[model samples]
Target: MSSNDKLPQLAAALRFSVLAYAMAYGVSAHAASEAVELNTLSVQSSVIGTSEEKDVAKYPGNRTVLSQEQLKKTAATSIDGALQHVPGVKVQDETGTGVLPNVSVRGLSGSRSERAQFLMDGVPLTLAPYGHTGQSVFPATFNTLDRIDVVRGGAAVQYGPNNVGGVINLVTKPIPNQWETQISNRISAYEDSDNLMNNLYLRSGGWLSDDFGIQFSANTLNGDSYREHSDTDVTNFDIKADWLISDSQELQAFIQRYNSDMEMPGALSPTAYEADRQQSQRLNDDYEATATRWHVKYLQDLDWGNSAQLEVLTFGHHDTRNFVWGFNTAGGHWADPAQPSTDIRNSPREFNVYGVEPKLSMSFGSQDTLTQNLILGMRYVYEDVDYRLRQTNINTGAVTVPRDWGLKTDAVAAYVSDELGFMNGRLKVTPGVRFESIHMNFEDRNSGATDSNQINEVLPGITAAYNVTDEWVAYANAQKSLRAPQIAQVRGAGDEEGEVSWNYELGARFTKGQSSFNAALFQVDYKDQLQWQSATQTFANIGETRHQGIELSGRYATQNVPGLSLGLAYTYLDATSEAEGPNKGNELPYASKHQVSWDATYDFSGYLSTLSGFYYSDAYSDNANTVEEDATGATGKIPSYMVWNFNVSKELYQQNNTTLSVDFSVNNLLDEEYYFRGVDTSPVGRYPGLGRSYNVTANLTF
Candidate 1:
C-alpha cells in the first residue's frame, strides 16, 4: 500500500486495537457464566476448579495470578500490599490507605507506574499514558476485583505501549446467571491510628426475557491512618450489563466512577525522623482526584467457532492538588533541612480520553490434536489534557497563575497474534506483532511555545512451550518492546530518542500430588532507556541498564496434616545502571536485590489461620550510591528490614448458600520500623514506615 493509502487503513484499523485494549472482556463474561452452575447463587471464587490461571500462564514467561479466595485470606489493606509476595513487582505504600502507590517491575522506574501497563476489565485506566506516563493519581482497592492477572515477558507483545515492564489487568466483578449479593465491613487500628471501610455488591440476571444480566457494586474506605495528619477517603462505583443480541451475537456495557481525597503528611528529615516517625510536615495540604468512565461492546459468535468484537470507551479524569509545605532542598541528610524552602502552590489537571476498537479471534483444527488460534485487531485513541498551576505569595497574600500546559495526542495501533499447537496440544508456540503510530501536540501557554512530535514503531515477540507431562511444562521466549518519548521529552524536531529493550527468559512449571511451583530465569537489557529527573523536571535517554533475575515460588500441603499448607517465594535480581553516567554501576532504588516471602496456613473445618513474612535487602537511596552511618531516616543507604503478618478467620455460619465470615489480622506484627523508598532529589525525601497495626472484618454473603 502507498503511504497515503496505508495512512487511512491504519486509522480505520484503530478501532480493532481499541477492542484489543480490553483483552477479550466479552469472552471473559462467557467463560465466567459457563464456569458457574446456574443453580448455585453465591459469591464464590470464579477461578475455583478451573485451569484458567494455569492456562494464562505461559512458559518461559513471568506471570502471577491472584484469585478472590486468596484476596480474602490476605485481607490486605492495599492492592500493593497483597501483591507484595508476587515476584518481579515492587510496591511502596505511600499513603497507608492504598491511595498513593509507587510501583515498578523488575528495576524500571516506578514514579507513577509509568513503565508498566494498567488495565481494568481490559480497559486502560490512566489519564493519558503517552502524554504524561504516570498513574500515581489513580488507586483502587483490592476488594473490588475478582482477580488480578500479571504478565511479564516477550509474550506481552500483544499488550502494546508500556509493555516495557509488563501488563497488569485488574479484572472486575463477573456477571453470573444467578442472583447474588454481599456486604462487608471492616475496622482497623494501630497504637495511634484507625481505619474504616464498607462494601456492597449486587448482581442479577434473566430480567430481559432470560437473555440479559446486570451487576452493581459500591465500596468506600476512610481513615485517620498510621501517619499523622494523613487522612484519606475513597469511593468507587461500578455497573455492568450484558445482553444476548441474538443466537450468534451478544452485547455488553460497563461504567465506573472513582473519587479520592488524601493528605500527604510530607516526608520527615533525618533528625526529625529519628526523633519520631509519626510527625507531619505538611499538615493542611491535600489532593483530590476524580474519574468517570464507560464503555459499550458488541460480540459475534461465528458459526465456524470464531468470534469478533467491537468496543468503544470514553472517560474524563481530573485532579486538583495543594502543596504548601517546607521540604529539604538538599538531599536528605539531617533530621530537617539546614536550609528549608517552602513551596506553596495549587496545581490542577484534566484529561478527556476516548477510544474505539474491533477485533477478530478464531480457533481452527482438531480440539485434541493440532489447533491454531489467531487474534487480529486495531484501535484508535485520542486524549486531550489541560494543566495549570497557581502560586501563592505568603507575605503578600496573593495568588497568581504562572504556568499552563496543554497536550493533545492521537494514537493508532494494530496487532496480530498466532498460536499454533501440536502433539495433541502438549506443545504450543505463539508469535505476535504490534504497530503503533502516535502524534502529540504540546502548547506552553505561558511561553507561547508550540511544538509537535510524530513517531511510530513495530514490536514483535515469540513464545514456545512444551508440556513434558500432565504435571510438568518447559518454555522459552525472546521478544523486543518499544516505548516512544514522553510528551515533555520531545521538542519541535529535537534529538530525543525513544526507548527499546530485548528480553530473554527460560522457565518451567510443575505440579504433583500436593505441591506446585514455578521458576524462571530472565534478563532484560535496555537501549536508550528514558529517565525522568525530578531535579530538572525533564526526560533524558539514560543510555543503558541491565536487569537479570531468578524467580521461584511454590506451595505445598503437608501430607499428614490435611489442612496445613506452606508457601514460599524468592527473587534475586542484579539490576544496575550501565550507562557510564552519574549512576553507572549503582543499583536501582526501591526494588530489593534479594526479596523473599513465606506463609504458613492451617485450614481445618470452619476456622483458618495464616502467618506471613516478608524480607528485603538493603539498597542505595540515590544514584550516587551515597551512604550515611547514622540510623537517621535520610541515610543515603536504605536499610534492610523484615516484617510479618498474622491472620485467623472463622466461618460463623453457612446454610442455603448463605454464609457469614469474621476475620482478625495484625500487620507489622513485631513493629519493626524501616522505610522502603526515598526521594533523592531533596532533603525532605525520607518517608517513615508504618508501625504495628491490627484489623477486624465481617462479611455476609447470600
Candidate 2:
C-alpha cells in the first residue's frame, strides 16, 4: 500500500489506542455506575436480564440495532415498513396494512414469518413450530417499540430452534423515573377509498414507591386500509412492573393482550386486476385474532462480581378465517374469474400454549483485563390446538362437511455458552451448544386417524472477533441452525429428518468521524430443505440447498451540509437448490437475487426529514421454474419493482420530561404498479403491491 494509505491507517490506530485507554480508565473509575455507555449500540450492562448489556463491538456475531432516533426518521406504522431498509432482510406486504407481514432473513422462506425467531425483551414470542400458523409470533404493537435488535448468524445456538435465518428482538420503552403520560394519534389517506386510517396510542408510567415502578399502555388501530373491504379494527393493552427487593435483587413482570378483526378483500382476478388493481370480488372474507401473554423475571447480584437470573413466559392465541378463494383447482375452476363456488371454506383455529425457561449467567475476571462470561439455560414448552373446517354448500347456502383436528406438543431444551476475551479485550471468542427434544401428537377425530412423533437434535456454534483499531474490526463465525419439521412432516420426523443448516460468515466494520460502513459475506448449506407442495398440503425434506449472499450497509455524513446524511443497504443473493434435486440449479422460491434500499436524511431546526426507496429483483414463486400463467390462475414469477417513500417531522414542544411531535409521510410515491408475490401452484395467481398513500401523525408525552 502507498504511504497515503498507511498514513490513514496509522492515524486510525493511534486514535483507537487513545480511546481504548480512556474507556479502560472510565470502567475502573466508575465502578459504581449502573451501566457504561461505549457507543449508541453498546452498553456495559443492561437492566432487562442477568447478562446486562455487553459491548456491541466485542460481540462476534453480525448484528444491528435501530435506535429510537433512527426510527423517528420515518415514523413507520408497520414493522415491514421499517425493516424494509435493512439489508439481508425481506419484508413482504401480505395484508397491505402491516397487520400480517412475511418477514424473512438470509433468503429463508417467510410464508408466515416462521423462518426466524421473534423476541420481546429476549423472550420467545412464538408457540407451535409446525403447521401453517402454528409457529406464529407477536410482540406487543409496532408503535410501542423503542428499538429493534437483529442478529443474523449463530443466533440459533444461543437462543434455540426457529432461529435458522436470524433473531429479531423488539425492545419496548422502559418506565421513566418520574410519572409521565403520552398520547399519539394518526390519520392517513388511501387510494380510491373514502374512509381514512385512524390510530390512537396512550402510554403512562411512574414510580409507585421508593423501590417500585410500573408502566402501562393502550393502543388502537381502526378504519379503512388501501383496498376495498379491507377495513381493520385492533386494540392492544400492556402492563409492566418492576420491584427492587434490595440493592442486589430485582423483580420484573409483564402482561399484554390484543384483539384484532379485519376484512380480507381477497385477490383480484387477472382480468379484474388488469382493469383496476383496486377491484375485489371476495367481500365476505374475514379474519380475526386474539392473544394474551404473561412474563416474570427475577435478577440477583451475587456480590463480588457475579449474577444469576430466572424467567418464565406463557401465551395463548386464537385465529379464525372464513374466505372464498382460489381460481383453479382439480375439483373447482373459476369460469368467470371472480366467483369460485368450490373454494369457499371456513376455518377457525385455537391455540393454547405455555412455556417456562430458567437461565443463569456468571461473570469472572481479574481487574477486567481478561474476562469470561458463562451462561446455562433450560426450557420447557407445551401447546394444545383445536382446528375446525367447514365448507359452504353453494346450492343450499348452508354449512356442510366438517373436519376437526386436535394436536398437543411438548418441547425441552438446554444450552450452555461462554464468552472469553483476552489481549485487553482486543480479541474475543464465543462458543456455545444447545440440545433440543420435541414430541408431538395429532388426531383427526372425524377420520379416526392418529399420529405421534419425537425428535432430538444437538447444535454448536463459535465466533471470533479482532478489534484491529477503533475505526475498524474483523469477525468470523460458524454455526449450526435448525428448523423444526412442519406438522405435515412430523408423522415420521424420527425416521425422516427435519430441516438443518450450517452457516459460515466473515465480515468487517469501519467507522470514521460521522461515517460508518459494514460488509459481510455468508453461506448457508442446508441438509434437508423442506419443500412445500401446495397440491398435497405437505412438506417434504428435499435434498441439499445452498444460499450465499453479500450484504452491505453504510452511512455517510455530508461534509458541507450539516445535519444531512446518506445511508445505503444492499444485498446480492445466490440461493439455489442443490444439483441433486429435481429442480437442480434453480433459484429458491420467492428468494430475490438482488435487493437495495437507500435513504437521505436531514435533521435541523427541530425538524427531521427523510427520503427513502427500495428495489427488488424478480423472483420465481415455485421450484418448477414455470413462467407462463396456467389456466388455474397460478403464475410462475413475480416481477421486479421499486418503491419510494418520504417523511418529515418536527417537535412542537420540549420541556423537562414533556414533549410533543407531529409528522407526515407518503408511501409508493410513484404510484408504482406491481405485484408483491406470485404463485405457480396456488389458487391465487398474484398479490398486488400496496398503492400510494399519505399518513399524518401527532404524538404527546408528559
Candidate 3:
C-alpha cells in the first residue's frame, strides 16, 4: 500500500503517544507537589556529568571542554567559529552565518557532519539519528549555549551508531537561583559593502519558589552575508522548567521553536569567479525550514545505599524543510555561467522522531579495596519521514509533482559497562558492549515500489587510565563503531550493508600551577566505507580505508607579564583509501594534511583583549585527487589560506544589581581571499569564503 493511504493511522498514533506521555507526567508532577519541600541541590543529568576540569581528568580518553569564559573570550558569533579553536576539528563555512554546519573530526568527511554524532542537552540533534544521519536542518544557536563538550574516544559503548569520528554535546543555560534579566545586541558589516547584519538576544529567568524554577531565552538574526543576494533570517526561542520534588528526586523539561529562511548565492565558474567572486548567478535559489522540539527528564536516587541512581529521558521533534533552486539544462547542474535557466525545482521534506531512554548507575566496594562502577542503559526510537519534489515552469506559471515517497524506521539499543579501579584508585579500566537492532521500510507513492532492510550488530570497547602523578594522567582506548545505511541508499538497487570501523587512541594530559598540555595519537580502520557518485547521485561501498592523526594543544600563563596568556592547537592527519577502484591509495577529499590555531589574551584591570589566527593546508575536492582546475571550478586543488581576528571588551558599570558591558571585534583582519568546491546545493562551482568583517555588541544585565 502507498504511504498516502496510511496518513490517518500515523497521525492518530502520534496524537495518542503525545497524550499518554503528558498524562503520565502530569500525575507525577501533582504527586510531587504534595510532598514536603527539602533542600535543593544541583543535579548532573547530562551524558558527561558536570563538565568540570577535575571530572574530565578521570575520563579514560581524549576530551575537551570549552567553558563559558573561553567562549566569551573568543567572541565567536557562531558554533562553527567557536569550534575552530579545538585541535583535529575542521569546519567548512558554507554560509557565513553558520545556519548550516559542516564539521568533521580526525579527518572524517565533513559533509553535513554525518560521521560525527551531535547532541543538544544529551539528546540527538539530527532529523533521524538512525534513518538519516546528515544534519540538513540544524536549529541550534550559539547564544543559547552554556558550553560545548567534545569526546574523541571511549564513547561508542554508550552512543551510536555514527560515532566513529567523535561525540559533540551542546549544553544549554541553566535556571538561575535568583531573579535575573539580560539583553544583548550586535551589529556587523563587511568591508566594501553597505549591508548590515543584526543579532538580538534576550534571557529572563528566576526561581518562583524553592521547589520550582523557570527560564526563557530568545535569539533572532536578520542580516546579509559576505556574498551578494545572500540574505538570512532566523529566530529561536526556548523555555525550561525545573521541579525539585525532594532531595533525591528531580524533574526537568524544555520546549524549543526555531524557524529560518535564507537565500543561496550559487557557486561561481572559474571565469565568473575571476570576474566577481561574491556575485550571485542563480537568483531563485533559497532554503526555508522550521522545527519544534521538546524533552523531559526524571532522576531518582535509589535507596540501595550504594550510591545508586536511575534516570529516564524522553524527547520528540517535528521538522519541515523546503529547498528551491533553478536548474540549468545546458550545463546539467544547478547553475551555469554560459546559460542560466528559469526552470525551478522544489524539494520538500518532513520528519518526526520520538525516543525514550532509561539508565541505571551504581558503585560497589571502598577506596581501601578494589572499587567498581557499573552502568546499564536501554533506548528505543521511532522515525517517520516524507519526501516530495515539484517542478515549476516560471514562464507558464505551471507546476508538476514528479516524485513522492515515505520512510519509517524503528531502532532499539542496549548497553552495559563496568569500571574497575586498582592500585588504591590510581588506575582504572572499563569494558563495555552495546547491541543495536534496526528495521527500515520505504515506499514510493507514485511508482508503487517498496524496499525494506534490517540490521543487527554488537559493538565492544575497552579503555584504561593511569594517574602518573598528582597533575599528570595517561589514557588509552579501543572501540568498534558502526553507521547504518541511510533511507535513500536503501531505496537504490544494490543491497547495502552498514559501515563499520575500529578506532584506537592514546593520549596524555598534564596540568600544573600556570600551564596545561594535551596530546593524542589516533587511528581508524574503516571497512565498507561509502563514497558519493556525482554522476548517479548515489553512494557506493568502498572497502578498506584508514585515517591516522595526532593532535596537540597547550596553554600557559607568563609570570613575566601579569595577566598574559597564550594558547596553541595543532593537528596532522593522513587519510587514504585502499579499495580496488580507480581512486585506490588516494587521499580523501576535503581532508587537509595540517591545521593550526594560536591565540593570545591580555587582561588589564577589568579590560580584556584577544588576538587569534588560523591556518589550513591545501586539499583536493574529489576522490580522484585532481590538481588542475576544471572549467566549472568543481574539480581542483583548494589553495591554502590564513585568517586573523581581534576582539576587545570592557565592563562600563558594575553596581549592586546591575551591570553593563561593551565589545568590539574584527574578523579576517588580513582580508584573505579563499574559496571552496564540492559544497552542498552548488557542488559544480567555486564557493567564496567570508572576507573582512567587523562587529560591535552591547550587553545589559540586572
TM-score of each: 0.87, 0.87, 0.92
lDDT at 347, model 3: 86
Better of 1 and 3 by lDDT: 3
Query: Largest TM-score belongs to which candidate?
Result: 3
- Candidate 1 structure quality by residue, lDDT tens digits, 564-617: 888899999898888976788788766579999888888867579888878878
Query: What C-alpha lDDT values do all the predictions have?
Result: 0.68, 0.69, 0.81
Tens digits of lDDT, candidate 3, 1-702: 444654665565456445534433422211232222212211122335655555576677888888776777776778888888888888888888888888988878887788879989888898889878888788999889889888888888988879998788888887888988989998999988887889899999989999899999999989898888889999999999999776656788999999999998877888888888778876788999999999987766653324555667789899999988877654455555445776788889999988878776666666667776778887878888888888887788688888897888878899988888888778989898999898888888889888887888899999999999978999999999999888777776535667889999999988776678889999999987776677876678876788998999898987888879898999998988878889888998888889999889999786899898788899888889999997878798998888898888999999987999998998888888888884666677888888889999999989
- Candidate 3, residue 183: the lDDT equals 95
RMSD of 1: 5.7
Off by over 4 Å in 3: 1-47, 332-334, 396-402, 532-540, 558-560
Ordered from best to worst lDDT, the candidate numbers read 3, 2, 1
Q: Which residue pairs of candidate 2 clash?
A: 45-53, 46-53
Cα-based lDDT at residue 42, candidate 3: 18
Number of clashes in every candidate structure? 22, 2, 0
> lDDT of candidate 1 vs native?
0.68
* Tens-digit per-residue lDDT, 73-104, candidate 2: 75466778778877888876756667766787
